[model samples]
Target: MDLELRHLKVVTAIAEAGSLTRAAIGLGLAQPALSAQLKRMERALGGELFVRGPRGVRPTELGELVLERARVLVPAVAELQEEARRFGRKRAAGQGQPARYRLGGTHGPLLGGLVDRLASACPGASVTTYTSWSTRELAGLLAEGRIDFVLTGVCGRSRPPSGGGGAALVWREVAVDPVFVMLPEGHVCAAREEVPLAELADACWTNVPGDGCFAQCFAAACARAGFTPEAVYETDTASCVHLVQVGRAVGLCRATFPPTPGLVTRALRGSPLMWRHVLGWHPDSPAARTAEAILAHTRAVHTRAAELSPSYARWRRGHRAAL
Candidate 1:
C-alpha cells in the first residue's frame, strides 16, 4: 500500500506528541487503530518510525527525516482539501448563487471597514471574512485559493514575505497604519500624547507569537531606538489587549483601533514603526476581478479611517502624493 497524506500526518503527529496514545487523541482515533495504521505505514516505508519507550516514544533518524517533509506536505494537502470543499459547496449551491469572496486577515480597523464596504458594494454577493494573526498565513491561504484575497499589514522597513504559494500573487497597498503604544489607562506614560521608544526600554511587552513581518518591524524599530523590547507574553488580540488593560504589560497596536476603556494609545515618537494594509490575490483566479472592485472601495474606507485617526491623518497628509 502506498503512503498518503493521512499517513504522513500520523507520522508527524506521533513525532510531535511523543506518544501514540496522545497522537491518537489529537488525531481523534482509537489507540489500536492508530497503532495499526502506524504499523502499516512503517511496513510500507520499510522502517520503524518510532522507538517505543517506557515513557513515551521518540522518532528514529528515518522518522525525523520523514516528519520534516511531512510537516510541509500535510498542510499543503489540507489546504487543497479545504479549497476543494469550499468550491464544491459553492458549485452545489447552483449557478444562480452569488459570487463568493473569502477575505482573510488580522483584526484591525481597516479590515472591519473594508468588510463593511465590500458588503455594501456587492449587496447580492456573499462576503466572508477570516481572521488570522499572521499576515504570512493569510497570504498563504490567498495563494492556495482557499481564501480569495487577503488584507494584511506589511512593515514599511521590512517587506512581508510572500508565502511559498504566493509567487504569482499581486500585492496592492491600500493604506498606511502607524504603530501606537497601548498602555493601561492609569500607567505613568498613559497621560503623555506621545511616548519615546527609549522610555519603554524596561517595560514588559505583549505580542503575538510569530516571526512575521510585523514582529520583524517592531524588533528593527526597537533596535534603532537603542533597546530591544522584552516581550514577556505571547497572546492573541483579545488577550494582548487584556494584558495592557490590566496593567500587566504594554502592547503595540495600530493607530486606527478604537480606544478601549482601560487602555490609552500613545503615538510612538520618531515614527520608527509603521505598516501598510495591503490587498493580495492571485492574478489568474476569478477572485482577481472581485479584487478590482474591492480595491476601489478599500481605498475609500481607508481614507475615512485615516480621517478618524489623528496620527494616521498626519502621516497621510505628508504621504498624500505617494498614496
Candidate 2:
C-alpha cells in the first residue's frame, strides 16, 4: 500500500509515544491491529521505522528520517483537512448555490434586517441568507462567487477578512457597538447600570461560538482589570441565552441583544471590548451595484436594535465619544 496521511500519522504517533502498544492506545486501536498496520506501512516504505525492545521501541535510522518528515506532513495535512471541512460544510449547504441577491453573514441581527429590506426593495429578486461563525469562510465564499455580500462584526480594532485570490472587496462601516454581559436578573451585579469586569472574576461565562479573536481580547481585558476570568463556555445562541437565564453561567453579547424575561444585558464599566459592524462585497459582484443601499439599511437596523435595549441606550448617551 502507498503511504497516505493516516500512515504518516501512525509513524508520527509511534515515534512520539515511544511504542507501538502505547501508540495503539492513544490512537484507540488494538495493539495487534496497530502492529499489523505498521508492518504493512514499513513494507511499503521498504524499511522498519522502529526497533522493538524489552524497554519498548526506539526509532531506527530509517524510522528517524520517516519520523522527521511525518511530523511535518501530518500537521500540514490535518490543517488542510480542517480547512476543507469548513469550506465543505458551507458549500454543501448551498444546493444550487447563489441566489439572485445572496448574503453571507456571521451570527447577528443585521443580516435578517438586510434580507427583509432587499426583498422589499427588489420585489422581483430572490433574497437568501448564508450564515456562518467564520468571517474568513464568508470571504472565501465571496471570492468563489458563491455569495454576493457579507455582513459581520470585528472586535476592537480588528480588520475585516480579505477575499482570497486578490479579489478586491469594499467594506463599509455600519455601526460601532460595545460588547456587553448578560446576567440573571436576580444576580447582585444585575442591578447596576454598568457591571465591572473585575466584579465577574468568579463568574462562569458563555457566548455564541465565533471564529474571532474576541476571546483573547476578553482575557486581556480581564488581565487589565486585575483578575483572571473563570470558565468561559462556547455554545450556540439559544444555549448561551439558556445558560444566562438559568444562572448556570453569564454571557457575552453585542449591545443590541433584546431583553429576555429573566436576564439582563449590562454594559461593562470600562467598555473594555467593542464590536464594530461592517458589510462587505466583491467590487466586481452584482451586489456591489447596490451595496450603498444595503449598507444604509444595515446601519438603520443597527441603530434600531441599540435603541430597543434600555441599558445600551442609556450607556450610549453617556459614552458618545467611546462609541
Candidate 3:
C-alpha cells in the first residue's frame, strides 16, 4: 500500500484520460478493477485523489500535489533505466557474451515468427518474450529498456500508442491486413463470401480486449452501418473462439487468423475495416542494429499467412486493400 511508482502511473493516467473507464482501457484494466485499485491507493495515501463526476473526474488539492511530483519522477526514472541498459549492453559486448533479444507484444502470429527467425539467424543467441494486452504497458517496458522490440497492430488510419513511453519509440509498418469476421461454419452469414457489416447488427459479438483503438473503431464502423452491436463480450482469444464455435456470437479476426474447426472467417463488404501491423523499438537500443533484417522476417511471415488462408488468398486476388 506504500505509494509506489505504479500507483503514480495510475494517478497520471486517470488525470490525463479524464475518466476512470478510459484510463482503465489505456491501462489494460477493467473499470471495476481500476476503481478498486484507486480506492486502495486512496486508503494508503490517506486521501481521495480524484473527485468523480458525470462528465469525468477532477483532481482535489491533495491530488494536484501528488500529480505534480509524479510527473517529474516518472520520466526521470525512465531515463535512468535507459542509461543503465545502455551501459549493460556495452559491458555485455566487452565480455563476449551471446546476443540478447527481449521482445514484447500482445498475442499475434508475427511475434512467434520473429522469434524463430531471430534464433535461426543468430545461433546461440538469447531471445525472450513478454506479452500483454496494454499498448502503453508494452511501450512503457520498451522505454525503460526492459524489452528490445514490440510487435503490435492498429486499426485503419489509427496511430500507435502516443503516450506512456510511446513517444520515445520509432514504429515501422510490418504489413496491412484486412479485418475479417469469424462465424460458425453453419451460420447463415457463412453462405456469403463477403458479409455486410449491417448483416450482423443483431448478433452478439466477442473480441479479445487490448489497449488499442480497435474496439472504438469497431463501434464507429457499426455506427456507419446504421446499428449498434447488441453486446460485446471481451475475453481471451480462446474464449472468443469458443463463443463463435458455439454459435453464441460473431468475432472480429485478422484476415490471417488460421482456420479452426467449425469456424469460417469472411471478408466484410467494402473492406470497412483493416488492421495495420506495426513494429517498434527504441532507436538508441541494440535492436536498432538489426531492425532491417527483423522487418524483412516479419513481412515474410505476413505473406506466408495470406497464402495459407485460401479464402483470403482468393479474395485478395481481386482486391489490393490488404496490401
Candidate 4:
C-alpha cells in the first residue's frame, strides 16, 4: 500500500509515546488495530521500523530516518490545513469573516470562564477549545500552528516545551493551585480538616496512567511521605472522581475542583504539593497580542474559584506571597 500522512502520524506517535499501548490511546485507536497497521507499514517499507521490547518500542535506524521526515511533513501538512481553513472562512464570508482563536487545555475549573471571557473580549472572533491529557502533546500542536494557545498545569520540576516553532512560545504563570486529596464522604478521614499523606498509604489510589508532570509530582510526594502509592485504578479525570465517590479509591485534585456530592476534599497536611497553571502561546501569534488581558481575566477567574474551596482559602491565607 502507498504510504499516507496518517501512517506517518502513527509512527511518530508511537516513537514519542515509547509504547504501542500509549500511542494507541493518544491516537484514539485500539492497540491490536494499531499493531496490525504498523506491521502492514513495515512490510510495505521492506523493514521493521521499531525495536519492540517488553517495556516499550524504540525506533530502529531506518525508523529514525523515516521519523525525521515524518516530523517535517506532518507539521507542514498541519500548516497547510490551517491556511486552507482561513481561506475557506474568508471565501465563505468575505469581509465579514470572523477571526478564529483555537485554545487547548486539560480539565481545569477556570476553563469555562476563560473561554467565555475570550469570546466576550473578541466580539467578532470565534473561540474554540480542545482537550488533551498530555500538555506536551498540546505544545506540539501549538508548534505546528494547529492551536493559538494553551492553558495547562505543570508539576515538580517539569518545564514547558521549548523547541521547533514552539521556541517562540511564551508562558505566564496564572495561578498556583494546591493539591488536595479526595475521599469518599464516608471514608474514615473524610471528616478531618486535613489528611496526612502517610495516613492514606494503605488506601487504593486512582491514578492517571502516565508519567506526565502531574503523575510525577504525585509519585514524588508519595515517596517523600514514605510509601509508594498503590494505584488500584488507572483512568481519566472523570473516572478517577467516580472511583473516589464510590469508595473504590482515593484520588488527588486541584483546589478549584468542584465539590462532588459523595466526595470530600481535604488538604494534605504538611505537604507542599501544588501544580502551577500556565497560559502559553507563540509570542508572534495574533492571539499573543491580547494575552495580557486574557491572563488577567484568567487569574481573576481562578482566584474566585479557589476561594470557593475552603481548603484552598486556608492555604492561601498563609501563602499569600505565592499567589
TM-score of each: 0.68, 0.70, 0.83, 0.74
Full-model lDDT for every candidate: 0.76, 0.81, 0.85, 0.78
lDDT (10s digit) by residue, model 2, range 165-237: 3556788889888899999999999999998899998999998766567877998998999988779899888
Worst 10 residues of 3 by lDDT: 159-168
- Model 4's number of clashes is 0
Off by over 4 Å in 1: 1-98, 310-323
Per-residue lDDT of candidate 3, residues 1-323 (tens digit):
77877689999999999999999988766688789889999999889999999999999998999999999998898788868877866975677544788889888777887888788988888999999987767877777778878888888877776436545688899888789999999999897889999999999999988766788889999999999999999999999999999999999998988878989999999888899988888777766777777788888888888888877887889786445
Instruction: Please provide, for model 1 over 1-323, each residue's C-alpha lDDT reduced to its tens digit, 9 standing for 90 to 100.
Output: 98866577678878889999998776645587689889998899889999999999998988988998998887787677558756754664555434687888787777788878877867877888999876656766776667887887767745655654225678888867667888898989877777899999988998665434566567788888899877658788899899999888999877776757788877788667877778888765656756677788778977787678655566557656745
lDDT of 4 at 44: 91
- Candidate 4, residues 236-314, lDDT tens digits: the string is 9889999998888998888787777888888888655877788888665555656787789888878888878776677
**Candidate 4, 191: how far from true, in Å?**
2.1
Candidate 4 lowest-lDDT run of ten: 157-166
Candidate 4 ranges beyond 4 A from true positions: 1-47, 52-99, 120-124, 163-166, 209-211, 318-323
Best by lDDT: 3
Stronger candidate by lDDT (1 vs 2): 2
Candidate 1, TM-score vs. the true structure?
A: 0.68
- The regions of model 2 sitting more than 4 angstroms off are 1-99
